[model samples]
Target: MNIVVILAPFSLALALIGLAAFWWTLRNDQYEDPQGDASRILIEDPEDRPL
Candidate 1:
């Protein structure tokens, strides 16, 4: 169908774009701290200075 023909390329392009973005994020260490934030919340804050 004409719709399929038109949509297939668009879908493929979107998939390729997504893959490229994922690879770029990995290369730049975008996901390296997945648990760091969660663990930070459990840490106690240091004593506060007197006002």
Candidate 2:
């Protein structure tokens, strides 16, 4: 009863904060190179080895 009244607004605020952060990331192109990073791991850089 009383606990729900207090907890509901708190939970909703947290959810809104999370949504804002996700929206900010989208506007910043944070996920643009998702596949690039994954595929890059499989690539070997020749310069990394010493002759």
Candidate 3:
């Protein structure tokens, strides 16, 4: 349909935008350490005493 022609470019633009964001995040080291946060939870904070 005619709507497809209009919507396809918009959808493709959005997809490219998303892919660019993903690439930027990867290049910027946004996902360098996936497990670092999980392991941090196992370490107890010394500032948590009854206050």
Candidate 4:
């Protein structure tokens, strides 16, 4: 019973923080280029090759 009093606000604060971060990403266009990013990781660049 007492634990709920302490945990409820803490949980709500964490949820709000997560939501804010998600909103920030949306405003910053961070979600763009999902497929491009996925395909990009598969390519091997010459600079990454062993010396």
Best by TM-score: 4
Q: Best-fitting candidate, measured by lDDT?
A: 4
lDDT of each: 0.89, 0.94, 0.91, 0.96
> lDDT tens string, model 2, 1-51?
999999999999999999999999999999999899899878889986569
Q: How many backbone clashes does candidate 1 have?
A: 0
Sorting all predicted structures by TM-score, with the top scorer first, yields: 4, 2, 3, 1
User: What tens digits encode model 3's per-residue C-alpha lDDT throughout 1-51?
Assistant: 999999999999999999999999999999888799788778788885456
For candidate 4, write residues 6-49 as lDDT tens digits. Answer: 99999999999999999999999998999999998888998867
Q: State model 3's lDDT.
A: 0.91
Model 4: lDDT of residue 14: 100
Question: How do the candidates rank by lDDT, highest first?
Answer: 4, 2, 3, 1
For residues 1-51, write the lDDT of model 1, one tens digit per residue.
999999999999999999999999999999889799789777776753344
* Clashing residue pairs, backbone N/CA/C < 3 A, model 2: none
**What stretches of model 4 exceed 4 Å from their correct place?**
48-51
Residue range with the least summed lDDT across 10 consecutive positions in model 2: 41-50
Model 1 lDDT-worst window of ten: 42-51
* Residue 32 CA displacement from its true place in model 3, Å: 1.0
Model 2 compared with the native: what TM-score? 0.77
